[model samples]
Target: MTEDFYCDEVLSDKIQVRKVLETDNVLAYYHTKPFWPVHVVAIPKKHIPSLITLEESDNELLLELLRVIKKVATMVTEENGACRVITNLGDYQDSKHLHWHIVSGEPLKQLFNERLQ
Candidate 1:
């Protein structure tokens, strides 16, 4: 995958995503490859690399992104009774673009279970 999948693929339209919520500077969509039964990804429309890379200029954008994430998380939690909000960084991040995942239901892979145990 490219370093910035969200910018190079999803945002650029090279890959299509089912959008859950969208504003001028943010987008919440169903993950192209989901890790959980109900997995949604929220990202800033503008490239921000990673959470650690966020600059002071990005404060407003971050707030907007969080707002979208909160809405998506609330929807998932209301339906599923519970959900998780997750983000990865450094080596754990597959895609460098800043993004948050709102997910519900058991993890589809045993790796997550093994790590938790």
Candidate 2:
């Protein structure tokens, strides 16, 4: 992600979403292959590769994004009683973009706990 970013060429086919809130440096939207009943992706508009490349200047934006995660979690949990906030990296993550997968549901919680162990 440290290198140049190519949006139209990079995500032209991966994304099934057209609805988004794009900033000068990031993109936020809902996920298509939802792990839970409610799933969305909060990804940096900039290409930063993964979370490992995070710098000090990215702190404020990350914090603000987290706050949004909390709000969404509350809403999702209110309806489902629990939720998951997942940020993947390296080989484990399917996507190269640094993003948060916000998901919630009883079944999802079970899946999350199973993966933890």
Each candidate's clash count? 0, 3
List where candidate 2 sits over 4 angstroms from the true fold: 1-27, 106-117
Let me know the TM-score candidate 2 reaches against the reference structure. Answer: 0.67
| TM-score top scorer | 1
> What TM-score, to 2 decimals, does candidate 1 have?
0.92
Instruction: Score candidate 1 by lDDT.
Output: 0.94
Q: Mark the regions of model 1 whose C-alpha exceeds 4 Å error after superposition.
A: 111-117
Could you say which candidate leads in lDDT? 1
Compared with the true structure, what per-residue lDDT tens digits does model 1 show for residues 1-117? 679999999999998899999999999999988989999999999999999999999999999999999999999999999999999999999999999999999877865778888
